[model samples]
Target: MDASIGRTAREQLTGRYVLSLVAFLALVYGVTQDIETVFAITLGLAFVETISILRDTPTVDSRWVGVGLGAFITIASLAWFAWELTTAAGTGGPVWFPALTALIGVWFIFDARADFADGTDSYAPDDMDASEMMLVLNHGHLVVEELRQGPKTVPELADACDLTESRVREALDVATDDGMVYPVDGGPIDDVERYALDESKVGGVAFVRSNGKRILRRIARPFRR
Candidate 1:
């Protein structure tokens, strides 16, 4: 499966952002055009985004409540919009808008299910290949370093890495997806989630550089703090 797709995780994430933004904007434009049912649907979508902002899944507590909320909102919005679209007559607005919305809805549903199962903070259409996995795990050196010392909470990793909590979580999720990391408590993460490293998977030139980087970071951490 390593060669399933050549795209990297970062590239996948960028594409997802662009696609979601375009879908959202099209709905807005449809509203301006007074496309029937577009207004209610847009409002529902807006509410979903607002909840996501308030919950802040990327940096939220590891209890998975925020993740569940995000998934819920996603499907709910689609359901509401779908109902509206079906019940009302089309203003014959751009045929493309509804089609795009449906496509995006399908994607959202798939991803929402995934987000609930695994705390993947980033978009992952499918399992990453070996090289893609390496690339993601490599960029998260500080997280690996902290985990090697022992298990760590998101805030602890964030502090150690001098990265925003959100970015630290993203790194953890990326590593987790590749089997390079996992929660210390096993199956379900509790209120205070602490992640541990899988040393078996940590071997390679990437970790060699990462080990050197960790050593350097340890030396400079005090001053940086």
Candidate 2:
């Protein structure tokens, strides 16, 4: 299962790199002949990338910022395209094009910075406890945080954590044994078991509420070195 997951991740990374290369080449080609086409294609690629990022990191602030930026870029690109179409052939565009493009470039830079700020580098620890610590620091906390809102079945937890149901079940089992999570009544489901955080446990609740950013940095510490 681990090998299969690694293979799937590799395939996805390869595909993203290839698509990015294609988009970059297309943008360069469009720049030489049709500036409007460049804007349209760039906007499309930006939207695609934004959607991919949001899927991987479904945080509320990131979602709102990404959507706002995407909407603005889409509207600006469309307006520029329309202007180009209406303008007479061989006539130049407005003087603000360069300034607007520069602002957009800055936006991209900030967007990338934000992604890095919220993202963590992958790490592989040899020790079993180390591995478990990393999981509890990241995915485990995420699961508990989600459950803090309400109880959730395995499938719901998996979806919330962007993990497989089997993986979520395994994590839940461990957490249950540790007395961090408890089985709750499964609503409308006969066989499925729902889980919730045991708020009565002070340590568990504190760990669930711990600073996520700090935990992510700790996870990436070894990798950074």
Best TM-score among the predictions, by candidate number: 2
- Candidate 1 lDDT score at position 53: 41
lDDT of 2 by residue, 18-88 (tens): 68868786868766787776776777775665444443442323434444664566566556656666766
C-alpha lDDT (0 to 100) for residue 91 of candidate 2: 35
Model 1, runs deviating above 4 Å: 1-139, 186-191, 205-225
Point to the candidate with the largest lDDT.
2
- Give per-residue CA lDDT, model 1, range 104-165, as digits (tens): 55444454455555655333223566786675556587789878898888888888878888
State the lDDT at 49 in candidate 1.
Answer: 56
Q: What ranges in model 2 sit over 4 Å off? A: 1-129, 187-189, 202-225
Clashes of 1: 0
Judged by lDDT against the true structure, how good is candidate 1? 0.62
Give the least accurate 10-residue stretch of model 1, judged by summed lDDT: 1-10
> lDDT for every model?
0.62, 0.62
